[model samples]
Target: MSGTELTVTLSGATAADARAVVRVLEPAFGQAKEEPPTSEDVTVHTARFEHDPADRAAEPAAGGPGHLSGAVTVTVQGAPEAVSMARESLAHAFTAQDQGSVSGDQEQEWQLLLEP
Candidate 1:
């Protein structure tokens, strides 16, 4: 992925719950390539977002009123700045707890637990 691209992974949640989280992030990063859950038994959903710094809105949009059944584990992977921006966006939408994160030379991975 590019520096401005972020990959969001949601696990231990239903498809609807995953979509709710993606909706919260759409405004900050624009539309994302969302991968629908493969089957009813599937527990993981993924979305890819490309953030354009030049086109960012002055004020990020607030998350919608969609509700989740339970807490969702979210994993965001991207460049350091991209991951940070995504974390901030998720915080504005849900009750997020910082789990932990790992950083490398060109990329970073952050894990968060989000509650409705």
Candidate 2:
């Protein structure tokens, strides 16, 4: 299977904010964790999920809140189906999460940003 990367960036973020986003994505992705070099300013998280090439409808599941001190960016690398699922999962996460905030066009990747 081919691999594609899905990146979600959160600006002015904190560790709690990163965890909140990960909590929403981990279940579906099979892997969700924050990257190292974390500081008071920024945090980077990555997720991984898989999907079948033949089965288009593969639905799987899976951020918010807190003022972003810097920004948190999440990148998920997986198949096409996985990417689609991650997007859908993120939408759900946005609603389900209290602190996670979404501004601007909610239909796109940069739509959501952690509050603080």
Worst 10 residues of 1 by lDDT: 57-66
Candidate with the greatest lDDT versus the true structure = 1
Off by over 4 Å in 1: 1-3, 35-39, 58-60, 64-66
User: What lDDT tens digits, residue by residue, belong to model 1 across residues 1-116?
Assistant: 23378899998888888878788888888878755454657778888988776776645566655478899999999978778888888887888899999999989999999887
- Each candidate's clash count: 0, 19
lDDT of 1: 0.81
Candidate 2 local lDDT, residue 84 = 56
Compute each candidate's TM-score over C-alphas: 0.85, 0.48
- C-alpha local distance difference test of each model: 0.81, 0.46
By TM-score, how accurate is candidate 1?
Answer: 0.85
Can you list the residue pairs that collide in candidate 1? none
